[model samples]
Target: MSKKFTIPSHSEIQNAKSNRNNPTPAIFQKRKQSEQPNESIIEENVPKQSSEKVMNKTSTFRSFQSDSKPTVPTVTPVSANSSQSPEKAVDKSGTYRSFETVNRPQKPLVSTTTPLLVNSKQRGNPILKHIHNVAWEYSDIVPDYILGQTTCALFLSLRYHQLHPGYIHERLKLLGRTFELRVLLAQVDIKDSSHICQQLANICLLADCTLILAFTPEEAGRYLELYKAFENKPPDLIMEKSEESFEAKLIDTLTSVKKINKTDAITLYSTFGSVKNIFTATEEDLSLCSGIGPLKAKRLHKAFNEPFIKNIKKKAIEEVNSTEVKEKCEKGIGNENDNENEGC
Candidate 1:
């Protein structure tokens, strides 16, 4: 008593298809393929290697449908056996592309042999450029390491608002520690720089700077003489004393040797210390000290060498008389002078 479903005949199905465009399985598949064309379009637009070959193919198979100038179009994919030729499709898709916009980088104008500053464009600090150049120029005289240390010390002092004293002292101390005596001594000879000498002298007094003193035997000997002279004299010589000072002795020495007046001589001595030091000092350096002029310096130089010069008039009085005879003669002369004064 079960009823069975009957299958429709082919004529009935054909009549229904003619009546409506209903999408069966095959039509539905075609519709789906048409909806998604992005991948196919991208693949079709990909250019073949050579544009010339594609252009030739386009000309051969293509017909001018319009009398107007034909513009080349981008290519789309076509089946090999389809009515669309590969050349026409490749040309139409613009896949025979030879056009490219590449960026070409510029070359630097550096040569292998160019100098450091010029080639590297390392202008350095404008203010320090001269100093840097000078350092390199005399690298043989002053090593890079020492120059760097000195410059750094100077910069630090400036930044800290320090005077030249601490900077100079520390640097000289470092030099001593490093045992750069020869260089230090050479620097002591700098006529244009007495700060270096003054610092060295202070170091010697402090007993902290030993390298320079040890390196040069001659300078050491001179320094020894100076020390001995200091020790034998009163502290007043170097310090303030009511009776006498180092300044006074120095003035006396200069006055004795130079035959200058007490005031001018004291001024010169106070300014330059000793006869020898004054004589040896350059005019410019002496002028900076105080109360020194070209004339004074010249006169001092002459006075310093006077001891060796012949003074005939003063030599006769220096002859030694026998002690007994000299006393009797002095007595006789005094009595005669007294009688003559009494008569007047």
Candidate 2:
């Protein structure tokens, strides 16, 4: 069963190659037709189906994404309003007006039931008799009198001050500067009162106090009574008034004396040309006026050029000032340049 090994001729091989190129060979042509259908089938039908599904899915996704994307907004312009209330509405425009105010602080209330509070030690003093104009209460106080919340007074009689000159210094040192207003009410009682008053003035000046000199105890008591009565009143109540009209001024000036009235004041102005003429007029000339009587004329004439405080012999104060006193020459030193204690 062995076969012989033989090589094909070249002409036979050529003829078979020529057959592969020529589709007229029945078997080869049939094979090529079957193979071409399989390869071309995938290329035409499968690619079309697969590519159409993928294209549809991608196109749908792109459409959905484009629809879901946010669009650009349109901007609108707003105009400013002329008036707006801050209590209700807000101002969003360019212009805004605002105001701020503060509540006025309530004034601090000052409460004082009694007008004056006197020291219990001052119960026997005569100043209490003249204090009838205002109510007063007695309390154990450091100062002799207390007029108001911030005012206090220290009483010193010149008669007593002469007996103990060092007493006031101790009292003042103790009093210090506790009160806003301190008053040193001095009643002049001695012939050497001038010297003592100077010393008191110096002491009061150094101690930050106002010194009031009273010649009589009655005057001093009147001052104390008035101090309490007018504590709350303004200074203009007792100060000299400046009237707007000349008639008002003349009437005020003419009615200043006791027992003179407005009727008499007007009558005198009508009778006399001016105040100069009135001042030059005598009692007889003044009495000739319509309403003024003899007593009033004489009183008015006396009031014209009279001294309020007169006939008091006030001698010059003695050289008791520490600034003016000569230093002591103890040990009798002879050098001119040295102090008196060390020099002659």
Candidate 3:
């Protein structure tokens, strides 16, 4: 078996050799270049030298950051000697009761040694006695209505009529008719006090008898002291014949006159020392007494100045002497007639 072989044309064989030796046309070559990467293309795909250098520095920083980071220190746990169960904690059941504090009853702080208020019978202070005595003259003499009118007048007059202690005592002594004074006081009590002065005027009654009395501050004090001593004690005018008796009499006289609606009378009694003194008192002097109004004082002055018994006595004495002389002359004539008849 002999095989027949077809031979390639010389042009064809030369074209094959030329195609292998020479590059293709520009268009075909460009297509082939595009399809495959050259050295420049490969370099463009890779970073430039500066960028590669920066990448190297970033890698160094990452490594340094990883190495420089701080680490937490590890702590080892301690072991117990034995794993014994914990002992049960004991709790106390004892009660802590607060003590009951009782408050004691407080006692009143009174002193046992203090003295009682029992009155003593000793002499009282003399100055107090004097002041009380003086105040009584104002009270006994001055009425509430006329106090303002006669204040200065009474004050000056009373001040002027300053009695010595001895004189005060003597004046009180003379007015010490205690029984008669008490009777007068009791009668005045029975009478209607409002009509006492009026009734006396209507009846034309004279004061049955005049009580001579005097007032002074010392007398008031003495009476106060007497009352203090004898008050609540038994009455015995004779047995209690002390200074108190005299003081009682003085009080009686004063109280009687006061009760008779005659404060003016009492005031006059105080100033003049007796009814006689008031009877003789001038209008000006009586006017100075407290409660004596101008008209009443003037009336009293006129009444006193007009002598009652004094004038009557003078006239009676003159009549009696004249009658005695006339009787003697008639007796002598009758004697001559009897002689002539006997001779005939």
Candidate 4:
């Protein structure tokens, strides 16, 4: 069947066009209120669907998180009666360990052999080896007594080139019986060769030791001749008793009396010519001598000029007694002569 087409009237179309173009105020207000209600409905419906989608997404996230979590390992406590050591268990665990289970260094084992046994063959002599070892291993190889003796001898030798026998004997007494003469002499430092010869001569005179000098055959005969001449030489008694000359004797006398040395004595003797002259000379005269200072001159002058009171008193008494005795003898002789004449 063919549907009949209907067309709007002209008046109705014109009225619809007028309503769209210019609507009343009340109609516009009604349309806006209607649009507001529809928009509120759309907003409410959109929020409900969005909230449901968010809830579904959160549930899916929670399931994924549960599946991805790692499992915690379980640990079984080791029994005390276990065959393995605690260190072995700790090593197997490979995570945590105690300080007691850590590896420690071990000490090496040492043999019980003596040092002498080990080194004697290489050193050739056990005694020498022991001495070397002791000397090398220790700082104090010298004994306290030896050091003390050396120190004392050094001080004494520095002061006096020749040590007295009495003083040495006293020191020996203090050192007891174990003191060594060689060691003491080795420690003494005599600076001069002449002093050493003098010391050797003095030692020969004082001690019982004999010194021998060995020489090559080429020089032996010459030395032998010298030795013979020395042996045949006369004793030095005269030289010891008297000096080489009167000046030397005068120097020695001045040294003895005035406590001056040979140099000063020589200077004084050369200036004064004689001991009597030196005694009579004034302090000014002594000071004028070479090498004689004012203090030494004054000392010499005072010693020589001071009179001997005891001797003077003794001489005066003897003279007085002699005069009185002579007078008495003369008077007795006169009386005796007179008596003898009367008797005649």
Please provide TM-scores, in order, for all candidate models, with all chains considered together.
Answer: 0.19, 0.38, 0.19, 0.23
What is the C-alpha lDDT profile of model 1 across 235-294, one tens digit per residue? Answer: 666775453676667656666644365777667666666667777776566546456666
- C-alpha displacement of 89 in model 1, angstroms? 78
RMSD (Cα, Å) for all candidates, in order, is 27.1, 30.8, 43.8, 36.8
In model 1, the runs with Cα more than 4 Å from the true position are: 1-128, 131-164, 180-344
Report every candidate's CA lDDT. Answer: 0.45, 0.76, 0.43, 0.50
Give the range where candidate 3 is weakest over 10 consecutive residues by summed lDDT. 145-154
lDDT of 4 by residue, 1-344 (tens): 99998899999999999999987899889888776545445445444444446448555322222336555544444566867555455433455443343456666687432221111222231222223321121122222112222121111232233556455444434444342322223223344545554565565345432332222322322322333234325567335576688777777677865657889988887777777888999888998988888988888887777675747877999899778667666666557775465342
Candidate 4 clashes between residue pairs 3 or more apart in a chain or in different chains? none
The residue-level lDDT of candidate 2 at 304 comes to 90
lDDT of 2 by residue, 1-344 (tens): 99998999999999999878874867877898776645445345433344446458556322321336555443232335635444333244434333322234666697545768888988788657766666788898889898877889999888899889999999888888788999999988788677888999999999999999988877887888877777778898769767799999999998998899999999998899799988779999999998799999999999896666653333223333332334434443356555554333
How badly does each model clash, as a count of residue pairs?
12, 2, 2, 0
User: What is candidate 2's CA lDDT for residue 135?
Assistant: 76
Off by over 4 Å in 4: 1-241, 272-279, 290-295, 302-310, 321-344
Candidate 3 error regions (>4 Å): 1-260, 269-280, 298-311, 314-318, 321-325, 331-344
Sort by lDDT, best first: 2, 4, 1, 3
The better-scoring model by lDDT among 1 and 4 is: 4
- Candidate 3 residue pairs in backbone clash: 133-217, 134-217
